[model samples]
Target chain A: MAPLRDPALEEISEALHAAPGAETITRLSAIDAVRARILLAIEHRLYAPGEQLPPLEALAEGLDVAPITARRALETLVEDGALVRRRGRGGGTFVAASPPQIQDSAVNVFRADEDAIRLLIDQRCLMESALVAAAAERITVEECDDLEALVDAAEQATTWAAFHSADRRFHRRCAELSGLVEATSYQTTYEMLARYFLPYPLDRLGGSHREHRAIVEALRAGDGSRAATTTREHVGSLRRDMFMALPR
Target chain B: MAPLRDPALEEISEALHAAPGAETITRLSAIDAVRARILLAIEHRLYAPGEQLPPLEALAEGLDVAPITARRALETLVEDGALVRRRGRGGGTFVAASPPQIQDSAVNVFRADEDAIRLLIDQRCLMESALVAAAAERITVEECDDLEALVDAAEQATTWAAFHSADRRFHRRCAELSGLVEATSYQTTYEMLARYFLPYPLDRLGGSHREHRAIVEALRAGDGSRAATTTREHVGSLRRDMFMALPR
Candidate 1:
């Protein structure tokens, strides 16, 4: 994929500036800005896996950023296992394929489930619980409607893949509604893992749909505890469904 | 940190190639070879945080690999979050400043009770238990000696910081002994967090020392279960000590 700029990041940065006085604005350092730009580029597949990046000077010119700033951005990517580099006569930078292996010994099981699918569901639950707790105090009317629509879409999904995709989107939108960007970003790894192990089961879709509905109903009724409770149950069901789909 | 290749990686790759027979020689793919080279360089702090990497073409020439191949290596670095890229006048790649946040939750209260510290200790127990179980069937004599020395160093430490440092080394060495590099990497993160948050109570250091002796003795006896148990109890004492030191 071609490398492209992410206007959304700039838009978000602008919104942050406008929402607060200039004194309160937290401008990203050049390195962070460059790093975020590259991540966005990867997410959008503007720079697809296995593609070579332009020369450092060319990249700096294209991004309208300083060479050092771009350099840090690339370094951050490498640390995250998103890119690799080498030096010599015929070498240049290129995009990396796949993701890095995150070691998960029992000591640091992050969220404490063994199976990848189970961890994915638990992770979503933890984030949703945090978000719904906050959203109950501040969810906007428009957001409430949007959440309900997502639940409806999931409920109407005919196949497992469609239902699963909708399910993630529904939960993700909930996190968005809560207005916590970092929490949303934290789930990116889980999302990537989920994609890697796609074509999960549909037999348990009905159970998930019901749970999703309960969560929506609770949100509509402005009950934080109920929303959390429903979300927990829903996540539990997803965990079971995921395990069932896997061959022992 | 100078920007250079990782000597250890180079040595290992060379050793693998020098193993003589094709059967003994394991050739890494070009991408992996370059990636390993970069990691070795970075891990040894060849590229310090914020240090600019060599130009892509320059790197390619030095490595005697095609420019595209070199670019792929750089891309792998980017993917790993080690480096960032820029496009403009005087732009280049550079190392990342801070490590990525490992999606750790505040599950181990580490504060609520002696239970809090003990719970985290229990996690270490579980991890080490798994490691020992694996290691009993896999450890080499040299690794056992490393573990023994690490334990001795911890026992000899006087200050809280020194003891904690040695304690981390001991536990990490134990994992390394298990021949599970990936799991041991996770153990490194666990050790970092534990060391960061768990303060040592100097007065109780003697008890911890005895526990370490017990663990080593168990390992010497080739009793995996006993070694695992001893390690858990040893970590448990540290937890209890932390509890007593907590602000009343």
Candidate 2:
């Protein structure tokens, strides 16, 4: 929920490391994979602050890892302030209400693969197009108005994290409006792609806000075909208009 | 995997129980939910036959179930002949290489939810369309030949299980041809919907083999749009054609 580091500082860091469409990191080690998965779950709010993680044995099983490996992942996360361990009765490891914004590099795992990035983009386009078409058919006037309000909120958001939170809600609303059960898969795909996203400046995010409004207009008119086109244009522009699509 | 029950008899059973589009069962109990998850994992081949399963503590953790509850689910699965146990060295509960085919009703859990079925279908449509389109862009003639062979294999399959096996491979090939790293997500989405699939007659399956050939033709011609359209029409027809659409 906080910036990974100072915005200007991080941008400069990213620019320095820019490799231009090359593999950004080596393949993830298994321990790093586990650590990243748990971190993602926290960011995804699967484990809310104050929520207890499953016991280490269970966590290991869930992750299909050895108990010692799971223990090591927990130790690193706790040390970085992402998780906490409490002992004695009625106590266990818990997500830190304020997980330290340490310079943990585990979350960088997703950007390592060129093929995954391409696949996710293609997958997102397909799912987003389908969802937007469906939403145009079913979204109510009230829902459209609520969507506009979300757009306004994002435009006014003060921080990268706040913008991100609203951005997720806005896209999730598009999927939900489709009134389809499998819309949940859209979120899963979206999150996987989002992991590859580096932070964007607020003003650049504001540029994207216009496309969001255009999508709402198409939905309000109940034009599925137009909405789908508008949606594709929006997603396609993601690589160019904002976010990381460069050699970084 | 063994047939869920007597093949001929189950077909007749399916006919009698068919409601044409109604929810046939109540909501899944949590234990049944866990049971279904494990069964699906087996069917997906994540845990191979004769492979040892995680210990109770780990399995429970992985499933987010209490140890007692996880035990009950495993017990029911074992009783149904889907799993087995052996004592002593390297011994734990294992998937029965020749697990007995029992009329265990837990596999029916997925069909209980109308929304989930529809969602899975929608989600599949999006992902499959994307994968097929990407496949057309990248498939080599040799890969196309391999796909044609899989289609042929499905045509020759004598049992529903055999057809199902080839069917999985054929679709998986579509994703793999794209050479996209996240193509694995396609398999995940496919298996989730497959959990809701009812067995179709082999002849009925044979009738659907035509579409597979059409898809291959489009891919071989390097026609991405055509391949994608053919894929959509093929998936769309699933509701009315080969698979379940009636309220049973």
Candidate 3:
């Protein structure tokens, strides 16, 4: 197949090559780029479980890559247990019935380096602080109420599992209320980084709930500075708590 | 060759596949992962320009991937203009004599979406704020002097080009002074994002220099909060300035 004639892609390519004195370019091969897009789509649930992917030829045509390239990409996914291929009538590639679990080892790699963990925390602090500030400025009373309700649900949670679920929802809702589409991606990435620090101590739940309450109050009052400060402190506390709990 | 059996590769693969309840696991082909690692190393200058890479067989052995996979990874790099392969004796893979410029298209892809640009700025604000705060608390007198020197250089700069170079140095030095190794990577990523909005109008150079002076003063005084505020404002101003300059 001829390379896809995508104007956006072409524009990107031109900008990279033509930028004067450009030293180095960060790039992905055609196959890798296609794979990344498909993976992202699947992660976002654009393709439901057990969904059949288009035939190799059609998939290759859509992405504007050779069929061999597309097949290689699919093969890689198959190796990762993300897809299964079958032959015969009505047989083709399908999302795996049960995709392999992200090995603990993978998460371990992210959490492996002490410095990386701290950096991740620093990054989260920065993104969330800005997000809270924006949310405070734009959140309506109804959205404030929604956040308060999530906080209440967390406070009343009888199990760690239930409380954790509420905690995730509250933070996510806060991002949504910020009215920035980009915050959603930040929130998603933040959640992934946080997975390594999950099952926060039950004893600290009360304090955490209070912190959430403070954030909601700040948002309700349209106090951007206060919202940012509270968010920073809350996230900072997580980092502190995690570091302190690590074995010496 | 049988899949190169390296403990490190096995660890990574197991970690990827073994995470419990991993509904979706994002992965790279062995070739892609190896390529990414080598590329990152090159970008970081682990392999300087003009440096010759080890033979393909050795690289394959080191990464514990099949020799063919390792060869494919190198081939991809060659295709990207990151490396050159020569034929006959004394020829292996060497860093390209003159690497292809990172295409303007790649940078444009980053700057194409207005919201993505904004999100990038917000992320930078957060990280830099935290970084400056830390730097304020811990920066030594010698480090403070070093920063002041950079600021002075910017102020004395007769040309916009000179000022821009000093400006980049000043910001990078700030991250380094923070005593956080991770901050350096954040600073690098932030600079790449900022490149698209560069070539500050000559009129704004003086104002930008003053902001740098204020940040230096805050660092000198060991005022973490003030340093954070000043740094945040400085970065925020860049975002504001760029947005205002964009065509309506």
Candidate 4:
């Protein structure tokens, strides 16, 4: 697969080239630039997820900068969710998931699970309601097929983990149907973290799948409020279940 | 001010110490472990915001590991939004922010502008309603003071920027009071981004301050629905104002 490049890479590279800093060119300023480069590097698959990063010496050499400069640059990427570091024997650098496609990028950079997964689900519930409402108002014919297939996958899955994965795909599909792909990163972060905090059992999947069908039906009939309400319950139930299962 | 430390630093240090081999950990595995370290570091201010990081060699030496191992550990911290780096001259690593403190952390992570900010505010409206409802059912006296003070700050502000700053504090305080500090990051992210992208003229301060008073009164009265509704309008107006300033 072609590696993805960060949307911000070209802008920074261009800025770096355009900057008239003959003396200070070797120094780094604005940690965002370093982060942008790392993100771009990851997107390009120059550094694959779970793959160790080049030694700080190598990276500094490649970027034509100092080891501390390279080290700090990598550290910024770590802060931005583009890189991960390990310590101890055999520990090395690796890529994390691509930074979420953000529609609103002005907010402070979120470290994954900083808000934890539960809070992300709560936000997802809010966004899902709006997404369903939007999909009800304007879901394409092809999109309906996609949604059906996701639901079908969920129903066919026998294991809890598989069903949970399908459930995530189904909701993600719904969000995409609403034409909000750029906003998925915020929600995706939550779901990914939620995996660590609350793993769902397979038996809890049936009811939500049935509810998904109802939401689809509501969308088919152009009943936006109904579709939105149903979608809210569907996603909210996931949060509710996790909350109930919270270690007492 | 002393920089905030991430909360997971010590745990990660321990984990790294306990790991058995040189095999690189799995993607999420290393990501989560390093993430814990970054957070703990932030909590402890080991990596202060805007401060340069030690050279990669130094980190490796301190951790008693290979330079390659140190690279991986730092890489993960970058991805987790706990650090920022620069390259060339005058650049190194710096801590990003401590969690549970909203604006600084959330704003840097997400970008919220006019169109995107509107959607986020709308999302906030939904969450605020639910949060306030939950708070009404369960909130403390000390939390109430924090909420009230935020409103007072908003009312006393003289500039639109100052008012907006106080306004954010008010809403975030409400979220904190709701005892869902975890869920409030999204809202905090929105508020912080809005402050940056939707700066108002200095003249518009009073109107927002008035809205602040009304929302606070509602919360003070234990009127969850009223607090929810009023807060929605308050945020919705900011969104509307921002959209009005947009081209086309």
lDDT of 2 at A233: 72
Model 4 is docked with a DockQ of 0.04
DockQ of each: 0.01, 0.06, 0.08, 0.04
Say what the RMSD of model 2 is: 17.4
Candidate 4's C-alpha runs over 4 A off are A1-115, A140-142, A197-201, A243-248, B1-158, B165-186, B191-200, B203-248
For candidate 3, lDDT tens digit of each residue in A34-92?
A: 56545543543445578787667656654556889878878988888888888899899
**True lDDT of residue B191, candidate 4:** 40
Candidate 2, B106-173: lDDT as tens digits: 55534334344554566677777666766786789999999999999989976655677788889888
Give the Å shift of residue A71 in candidate 3: 29
On lDDT, the leading prediction is 2
Cand. 3 Cα-lDDT: 0.62
TM of chain B, each: 0.47, 0.57, 0.53, 0.48
The TM-score-based order of candidates, best leading, equals: 3, 2, 4, 1
lDDT of 4 by residue, A1-248 (tens): 12223232222122222212222222225344345445544444445566666666655543444678768767766766667888899887777755543221211122222323344566766556656665666787777877888888878875544566676677767766765433354353334333232223345456888998998788778766667568667766755454333332
- As a whole number from 0 to 100, the lDDT of residue A7 in candidate 1 is 31
TM-score of each: 0.32, 0.44, 0.45, 0.39
> What is the alpha-carbon lDDT of model 4 when measured against the actual structure?
0.52
Superior candidate under lDDT, 2 versus 4: 2
Task: Give the candidates in order of DockQ, highest first.
Answer: 3, 2, 4, 1
i-RMS, each model, one decimal: 20.6, 19.1, 14.3, 15.1
